[model samples]
Target: MDLLRVRAARPAATGAVLAAAALLAGPAAVAQGDSTTQSDSTSPGTTQAGSGWNDDAYRGEVEVIPGDDETADMVSGVVFEDADRSSTHDDGEKGVAGVQVSNGRDVVTTDSEGRYELPLEDGMDVFVTQPRGYQVPVDEDNVAQFAYTHMPQGSPELEYGGLEPTGPAPEALNFPLEKDMGAKHPHQSCVIGGDVQTYDEDEVEYARAGAFSDLAARKDYSSCGALFIGDVVGDDLALYDSVRELSGMLNGPARFLPGNHDLDFDAESREHSVDTFRAQLGPQYYSYDVGKLHVVALNSIEYPVGDGYNGALGERQLEWLRRDIAEVPEGRAIVLATHIPLLDFADQGSDVHQVDEVAEIYEILEGREVITVGGHTHSIENLRAGDSLTGWEETFGVEELPFTHLTAGAISGDWFSGEMLEEGYPTAIQRDGGVPGVITLEARGEHLTERFTARGDDGSTQMSLGLNTPAYRDWFAAHEDDAGEAPEFESPLEVPQEDLGEAWLTANFWMGGTGSTVEVSLDGGEPVEAERTQQMQGEGQRVGAEHSDPTAVQQQLVHGGSIADRSMHLWRLDLPEDLASGTHSAEVTATDVHGDEFTDTVEFEVID
Candidate 1:
């Protein structure tokens, strides 16, 4: 009666299967919170996370109808409106007509009676796409329940326990739903947490202290919920329970994904590789609607050979994508969610990491408004429409992006590597010098905008402002061979008058892209435009110390982690060799394409 709360038996994840949790967090003991920083955040809200996290929200059990045979040709199901809040189809529950149901390939809408039948095959998922004004039920951990996986003989013995042998396909798979009063409103906040990728318990705690803290503290994404892009764990699928516990602390519903790290290494074939992940999490790929948007989760990783994975969708999945897009009306925007990017700034030249059939994907939704977000590279990237890469053209025959492609950097930044902050998480600076965080996609009807909240910090801290001197670059060249054990780049913010002309002020804007602007002002003087280092205009990647974020590299070289050798969002401006020498302050303002702006300040000294 309170919505279709499933009491029926559903898929159970085994202790040995790969289990997971979507992650977004804040600093439990934030070092950034203590910094002497002031700002006017580009953030839509004054604070990203509200104080209210509904720990006592409703929970429902998932259901999978019982059946006796594995040879059934078709499966039947009802999309009932649980008006009685009984969680079951009681005598009074009425069927909701016109709902869409799919068995992975073919999509069918329910008749006037709210029931539909589809051809069934082994290794397929039968799910209901929650229609506008209707809400799906969530489980104890706030993971939405709307699909049933059918794997009769289950998986071959995997390193992590694969799905247990589901003896037969069920005769009927009824999907329960409740009407959401708030669904009438077309605005929503959706969180995309990239790679959690926890390796062990300590890293799990690091995740808690970092991204999950940030996520749990936020009340904004309760309706659209949070979808973790992938890389749920680092090789150890055994850490699922620990991660799930962290997900339980989230303020809203949570969804997990599969990445290269979440594979079943011992599986016998390509399709079976992620059976353990699906068993622990939900479907491999599925779709759902929130407000005016239709979100498609894709399993883009193709493992043709043992343990060797590439970013490509199989024919079956691609065909499904075509069928999936056809169902949506032209008025709504489509958000494609995958673990590996359709194409990315981080791996623009690499064929394996970027989606192989990107041009085909672009062709599928030729005229529709499409936005893609993904994880895997572990860096923050905000590549926009018309952004082209020579490698994209050479490798995938894609000349330019048809729509925006946002890379949601990992919650477990740099594999959770680097010095621990006071919040109990590592600085974990990424290859792009962006810190660990989650990307929030705010949507009002079909229009979309996004922002990144770094672990242990607020919205105003979007960019890291600093000065890069010639001495630091020289030290970088000298210590290039020695990381973690290298001597600290001393007095990095101080400048010599002779080197002032060679010094540059840099802003590592985490979410800034081609349409974004970064301006600098000295001692509150008039602002001057700072040049973007690597313009996303069909150019090859510009790498090395000169292109790096000096602030992030200083921490990485002195501590331990991947070097932030290059970036797509970094902007720089050379300082003048002035006549006077004194302590000086520079203010930086970063304005995103949407015209939202954040201003931050950094202080430096010039000695004669």
Candidate 2:
């Protein structure tokens, strides 16, 4: 807390007094680019007592005192220079303007000269918005640079070094910039991940052991940082530090967007809704560029701050986004990342969760090649050419991936309560029957390919059953009381192994009644019953914690809640352990109570 005393202002003989004050501040006070000049004036109460002046001839001179604390309360430094000459913020240069600068609560902007002053709380994060045309400086090895350090005395120590230990705020937090070079598409790749809501320490371990572990082992993302699109934690803010540690496991930088669960539960107004998140992470909505891609991370959870909702980007953030995106070159691609899927497979009509102003957002990105990724709905959904999910407003009928709308499944699959695997992690199954993993977008000069890499397995072709049911109604209800019952099994009547090799039957049955059976037979032969094991599956039933019968309640509580009498049966049928590598036809059958039955035949290919 070094405080410099404000010097008394001397009476000016003319308009030159203010210019003198600028000189005393420092040599860096000279305007970098702007031409605005300062003017000198006197207070109304000041009277000239000199020889030539009468009592009422002159107003009192208002002394401008340089407060003993000349240091900015919030932002201590600015990285105004883009040292790499990339016109984008790199490792060591300054930050950009019109970016939302904050000290956790009071947000402000930088002046034309890229100079800003905002009040800061005791322990706050003062970050800049990496504007479109210019980039912040990068370090020696090319890590995106951070602004000045401003940690007040006695701020809590970062469990893992939170902010770099760089002393107090600098006198001038000035960032440098460079002119945007003319048209040329740069090779760019953006990393997109869906929901990573870790509920507890063990689940955090699951995340660490799963995809994150795989991410740690690779070096592919060293140049392009990782962007996690919401659901950083499962409603636990404490996991933020742990999450950061996970990011460190990567060879590149990692940024995050606030998911619904990442929100401050106790936040009252829009200003405060994401206070904790902002404090722990950075800004709620911000834009940055990597190569030719303009990445805009938005806060889509519009809940009430003081008077209205805070989910969608409010007028202020929306305006900022408009301006930010406007600065991006027409040829560049934009990636909008958020938590709740702007469009999703689950809950297509729920207004509270989906992006309300989807059309407006699309309009913002109409002409550009844009892609959106989200994670609230834990499923791996890829909308390729000519595909549109049900319930989307016609205006938002995304004909193509319209820049790929992918829903990254959760790391804690189905809440991490599944049966333990040989690897010691829960078999937390995914809703879409797809394995839990990360989606890597291989972007080589505008052309993009979507690849799904399962957590424990190498990146490979992933196919799972999308089971649903219009049959087997009674069987689902009969075993409703059993704690553990076999899933209604289905046997494949024919094998397409020769024609469609390496394909797995992903049974996405909807009414998998309690205790029902699903068996599959290759070659239209005898059906082998697939075991119905509870690995934390689908959003489990929700029930009251305190009940009259504790024993019965305890038995019913499988992972987080009691399995309802009839739950949807979503299962994946793997090829037989000893089946030869070739095409195989199989018949599947589901037997319900009251001697009723439903059957279907499908073919799949297998390869060694």
Candidate 3:
């Protein structure tokens, strides 16, 4: 064993991001036009990044040197600096010391010589935790190649082919890293997406036109890149290749965790469930560092023998988590990401949609500055510290939040169900009334901020302002069960004289929570505080059409989508019953915990 050496901050000669081998960014390009027709011209694929012009997937791969002739008991590797930009380490290349390597449970740092050895198991993933300032090699499709899967017997018979059997353990699974200044810079933007969930070729094109194109147009996240926190596909694992192609369309390297839908239903056991996903995407769970932040991507779903799936991390993974967290330096900013949320406001009542061991996980990171992000719930919830929910306390025993728990809204909102827009995608209005979008986790100095950007829309599209009236609620009650067949809620914004007393202005602030505030101003008057529907403190959920967003529900009712029956981010303020019956314009503003304000306008009327 050799003593550790400090890694220099300097980068290699090549200026391109070696991990993504991102095609040279030039002037922007416009994606293919949409086929669907719409009165509004706002659509996805209207503008795109240069990466879409040439869908290059020339990024290299990981180098796995075969083991010796005799059966090996260990999987060994050297973490080296790829000075010449090759994915493989040449004889002249030197190993970088102090880089961490793992075999699911054991985490060992490289010595001065940059070599590490771990006891190997039959179905373990041998991986390297990408250190700060350096990036691991990526496959042709921009999928990071930090880990190598070792499956001796492969998976038991499954619908989609699992990992191909590796006859013997590799002698050396060397990982190559390239220096990148942008990756370690203090200011970083990391994109988190939920539920790409493309079920068919048409849905694939929808994703291409929707979020993927949106991601392609943005060049901000070259370092931390984008992490699709599961549901990369819908049921069919063969679509993994298509998803990989989608990743190649990104302007940066892409990482993904396994969602429940990305499962192998034919598997006999949980051990081999996501084998094909691991082979196609990265590991089932892993960690990496960028600047001062450490991100741990976890596989939160658990499918058992003779049972359906649940939101439980097996003991094996729990032990791995213990080891993984122990390795991170104390006080380092940690971002815990999962496919199914650990704890969320949307599914605060369900046992399966939330992690079963949330309290235990919280205990593990007690002293650190941490924020958790997750997918699968298909809603945007930004629950801040000290926020509490009745079901959260009863089900998970979490009295109040220790830190932030964010439910990153889905890219394929409401599973691509709604009126087809000219954007070539459905208006996937989420169950929370939030439009389909992705979360951008930004690091600013010591604080990390999370912002949601709607698909094909600007940052100004943060909140939806509308009127939720008694008449609209009655219509919702009538059409509640008529999904995909409901008649349009007639004149939703116009409230009759009788219902005006009970009508309220609603603002669906997508990322609003306990510390956030929503204010309403009628006809340029003073802004009045709008009450949040759910306080998230020991109260049973108040769900019904009354709590729903009129803007989203109106769109969902006639077209087809998840009805916005209840949302934690919703706020309502009663309209003045004595106001004259005429057209009136109101301004709604939502201020988040970070003190950033988003303003939107709604024009409504009172009728006789």
- TM of each candidate vs. truth: 0.91, 0.58, 0.90
The models' CA-based lDDT, in order, is 0.77, 0.49, 0.78
Off by over 4 Å in 1: 1-56, 84-86, 304-307
lDDT of 3 by residue, 1-608 (tens): 01111222111111111100011010111011111111121112111244442243226667887765446778877899888767777998999998888888888999998899999888898889999888876777788888888887777777798888877888778988988766677667788999999998889899999899888877677778789999999999989889888888877788999999998888777888898798789799999988668899999989863467999888878888888888888646889999999988788888888999988898888877788999998888888888888888888888888888889989899999887776688877889887788998777533577778778754445666667887777888889888878876667668887877788888777888887898877888999999999888778778888888777777777778788888889999999888788988777767877666666566677898
lDDT of 1 by residue, 1-608 (tens): 00011122212111100000011121111111122322322223212443443543445544567898757879997888876555676676888898888888999999998889999988888888888777777776777788888888878778788888776877678888887644435677788999999999999999988888877767677667789888998889988778888888876667877888888877767778788788877888888888777889999888855448899888888988999889998778788999999999888888889888887888898888778999999899998888887888888888888788999998999998877666687778899988888888777778777777777664546777667788888998998777788887777777889997788988888899878898888887889999999998888999988898887787788778888899999999899877258877776777887776676666677887
lDDT of 2 at 574: 53
**Model 3 whole-model lDDT (C-alpha atoms):** 0.78
lDDT score, residue 102, model 1?
89
Ranking by TM-score: 1, 3, 2
